[model samples]
Target: MRDVAREAGVALRTVSRVVNGESNVNAEMAGRVHSTIARLGYRPDERARQLRRGSSQTIGAALRGTGGMWEHTAEHTARAAGFMTLAASTEDDPALYAQVIESLCQRRVDGLMVEPIGAATPYLVAEVEAGLPVVAVDRPLEDVPADSVVSDNAGGIRAAVEHLLARGHREIAYIGDSERIYTGRLRAEAFRSCLQEAGLAVEDASVTTGEAGPEMVADALDRMRRCSAPPTALVTGNNVISWQVLRQLGPAIGELAVFCFDSLENAELLAHPVSTVNQDLEGLGRTAVDLLLARLAEPERERQHIILPVSLSIRASSEVPPPPRARRRRAHKAQAPSS
Candidate 1:
C-alpha cells in the first residue's frame, strides 16, 4: 500500500480509501491507485480491512456431519474462496439446529449457508425475515424465504428411472431418505411420476424410506427381495444409501441395476461402476457464495431459488436385463404319431 501510494503520488489515506472502495477520491486518482497496486503486485490485508470496516470476513456453514463426504468438500471450497468457515452439524435434529443457528448469529457471521435439518425451523424463518443473508445449500427450507442453491433432484431421478426403463426394467424399486428433507421428497416424487408416465405402477411394497445406515439399508434390500415380484432395478436417494445398498448387495450388484442421486469419490472402483446423478460441489459452493454476496450487496431484492442442473453418469450398475419369462411346453403329439 505504501508503494502504491508513492507510485500514485497520493497520501496513505487516499490510497487506503481507494483500496477499501470508499467514495471521495476522483475517478482518475482511483484509476491511478488501482494501476499502481496491480503493477506492484500489492494485495490488501483482508483481515485488517475486516477489522477496520467492522466486517468479519467469515461465513458460517451448518453441515449435516463432520465426517460426511459432502461437508468435507464444502469446507475445502469455502476455505479456497478466502473465507473462514465456522461449521456445525445438527445430526438431523431440529433442537440442535436451532442451538447452532443461535450461536452463529450471536457471533455475527457475515453470512450463513446451511443444509437445513428439517422442513423449516422457526428460527431459520425468523432469521430470514430479520434480513439476515442466508443461503440454503442442498436441502432447502420449504416455508422460509431465502436464497437457495440446490441440485435438480427431480430431474435427475427422472432421468435415472428413464434409463432403467430403457434397459427393459419394468419392476424398479426406490430407496430414499426420511421425507423430512426437501431433496428426498423431490427425488421420491420424481421416481413415482416417471414410473407412472412409463405405464408402470410403483408398488408400495417395493418403495423403502428410512435412515441411511448400513443395517437399515440391508433390511430394506431384504424386504424388497421378499416381494412377490422383486425389482430388477433400484434407484437410491443419495450417496450414503447407495453405498449401504452396494455393501449389502456385494457381488450380486449386477443382478439388480442401481442408480443414485450423488456420486461417490471412488465410484470407478466398484465391481460394476454405479451410475449416479452428479452434482457440481464446487459450483454449488461458489453459487452459494454468490447468492450471499448478492444479498449482502442488496438486501431488498426478491428472494431467489437457484436450481443447478444434475448430470446423469451412465455406468454398468444401471445396465441389467429384464427377468426372463417361463418357456411354453412342447406339444405331446409325438406319442400319437408313434402309435
Candidate 2:
C-alpha cells in the first residue's frame, strides 16, 4: 500500500481508499493510482481481503472451451452484479475439468457456472451440497442436480428434418459429433425419431457421428452416397461439422440439400446461402449468468433448467434440391426405353 502511494505520489490513506474502491477519492487521484498499479503489476491479496470481508464476491466459470459470446456475456453480467469473474478452459477433458473446478473451490468463489463435458460429475454433487451454487450451461451434467440453461437440441433437429421432408426429400441424412457428448446424442436421436415418425427407414449409413475431421466427414459422405438409394438431403449437427461436410464434399454439396443444425458467421457468403437452425447462444450465456446470480442469492432454491428455443434460418441451401447422379442415371435409363 505504501509502495502504491509512493508510485502514485499520493498519501497512504488515499491509496488505500482507491484500492478498496471507495468512491470518495477524487477521479484524478483514482486515475493516477490505477495507472501506477497497472504499471507496477499490482494485485491485491484477495484471500486476505475476503477474510476481512466475510465473502470473496467472486464467481468462477469452468467451461469446455472458452472465448465465445457466451463467456463474454457471463463475465459482463457477473461484473454488473458486483462480483469478480474468474474463468478457465477445461478443453473437454474430464480430469482437467475436475482439477479446474477443485481449484476454483479452493479459492472459495461465491459460485460456479460450468459447461459440463463428461457424462457424469458425481464429484461435484458434494460441492453443491456444501453451499457452492453451480449452474450448468449448454448441456446438463448427467446425474448432477444443478440449474442449467441450454438450447433445445431435439427441437432444433426436428425443425431441420421437417423442413427437408416438407421440401419433398424422402432420403435425409445427418452427420454430427460423437454421441458421447450430450448435444450430439440428442440431435442424432431426434433426427432418427423424425425419420421414423415419417415412416421412413432409419438407415444406419445415413447417420454418422464421430470426430469432426476431414477424413471422417469424407468417409461418412461416401458411405451415405454408396447406399442403394442415397440421401437427397443432409443435415449437419453443428456449425463445425457443417463447414467440414460442405468443404469435404465441394460441388457435391449442390447435389444434396443441406440444413445445418447451428448457424455460422459466413453462412450467407457462400455461393448458395446455407440454411441453419440458429441456437440462441447469446441468450444461453445471459440466462446462465442470471441463473447463477439467482442461485448465489438463494442457495437452497430448487434447481431450474431453462431450455432456449432454436429457430430455422431458411436460405437457398435446403430450398432447392440439386440433381443427384442417381436421378440423372434414372432419367437416362428412362430415355433409353426398350432394352
Candidate 3:
C-alpha cells in the first residue's frame, strides 16, 4: 500500500481505500493508484486484509456445469453489490468439486455459492467454521449448515402428475437422472408419493432412475411398454431426460402424454410441445447472492434454507389423453402374439 501510494503521489489511506474497494476515493487519484499498481505488478494481500477487514470483494462460485443463466444472474447481482464473481465448473465430480472449492478459498474470495453434487461436503463445513460465507444453490450441501436456495422438487413433480391424472392417464412412467443426484432422488420420491396418494400401486417398472443414458432410457421404455397395462403418460425427471426420451420416441412424442420437470425453450416448435414445471433460475441465482451478502453482513445470523416455488407451463404434450383402454389392450395382445 505504501509503495503504491508513493508511486502514485497519494496518501496511504487513499491507496487503502482503492485497494479495499471502499467508496469515496477521488476518481483521478484512484485512477493513478490503479495505473501504478498495473505498472509495478502490485497485488494486495487479500487473505491478510480479509482477516483484519472482512472482504476480498470477490466471490467464488462452484457450479454444476458451465456457468449459464444462473451464474450470469448471480454475477450481475454480486457486481451490483460491488463484488466480482470467479467461477469454475465441478462437472459433477466429487474430486473436482473439492479441488475447485479449495482453490477458491486459497484466492481469498469473500464468499462462495455452490451448486452441490456427488456427496456430503464436510470440507466445506470446515471453511464455514473458519468464517467463510457460503451459500448453496440448486442443491444444498449435504451435512453442511449453509443457507441454500433451491426449487421445490416435490411440488414440481406433483404438478406434473396431477395434470396427467386430470388428463385421464392412469399409468405413468418416469425416466430420471441418477438417484445419486439430489434433484433426481427428490423427484423420484415425489412421483411415487403422487401415485400412492391417487390409490395406484407403485410399479418398480414405472420409474427408472440411474445416470441418464440413451440405453437406460430405451430399456426403461421397453419395460414399461411390456407391462400388462402400459403407461399412457410419461413424466421425465428433468429437461435432459425429456429430450433423451423424445429423441428415442421420435414420432411417438405426440401420442403419449409427457410432462418434463424443467422448462424448455422453443418447445412449441416441436411436433408436440412439452409441458414443464418451471424452476425460476434467475430468482434462484439472485436469491443465492442476496443470501451470501446477508451472511457476510451478519455472520452470526441463523442459517436459512429457501425453496422457491415452481409454476407449470402446459403445452401440447401433457394434454394428450390416455389411449382408449380397448386400443391399449389390443396393442398389447397384438405385440404378445408376435413375441
Which tens-of-lDDT digit does each residue in 75-155 have in candidate 2?
Answer: 888888888889999988888998999899888888889998864777788998888888899999787789999999999
Candidate 2: TM-score?
0.84
Number of the top candidate by TM-score?
A: 3
Model 3, TM vs. native: 0.89
Off by over 4 Å in 1: 1-54, 66-83, 327-339
Note the clash tally of each candidate: 0, 0, 0
Model 3 per-residue lDDT tens digits across residues 136-207: 998888888899999999999998999899888899988888888889999999999999999998898999
Q: Write the per-residue lDDT of candidate 1 for residues 1-339, one digit (tens) a residue.
A: 888889899999999999887899999999999989889999999778878987786788877666554556556665776568888887778788888888898777888988887745777767777778999888677777888888888989988998888888888999998776677788888888998998988788667887678877887887776666677789999888998888888898988889888987778777799899998776687788878878988999988888888898888888878666321012222222453
Regions of candidate 2 where Cα sits further than 4 Å from its true position: 1-45, 322-339
Model 3 RMSD in Å is 3.1
**Per-residue lDDT value at 262 in model 1:** 93
How many collisions between residues are there in candidate 2?
A: 0
How does each model score on TM-score? 0.79, 0.84, 0.89
The whole-model C-alpha lDDT of candidate 2 against the native structure comes to: 0.87
Ranking, lDDT, top scorer first: 3, 2, 1
- Give the candidate number with the greatest lDDT: 3
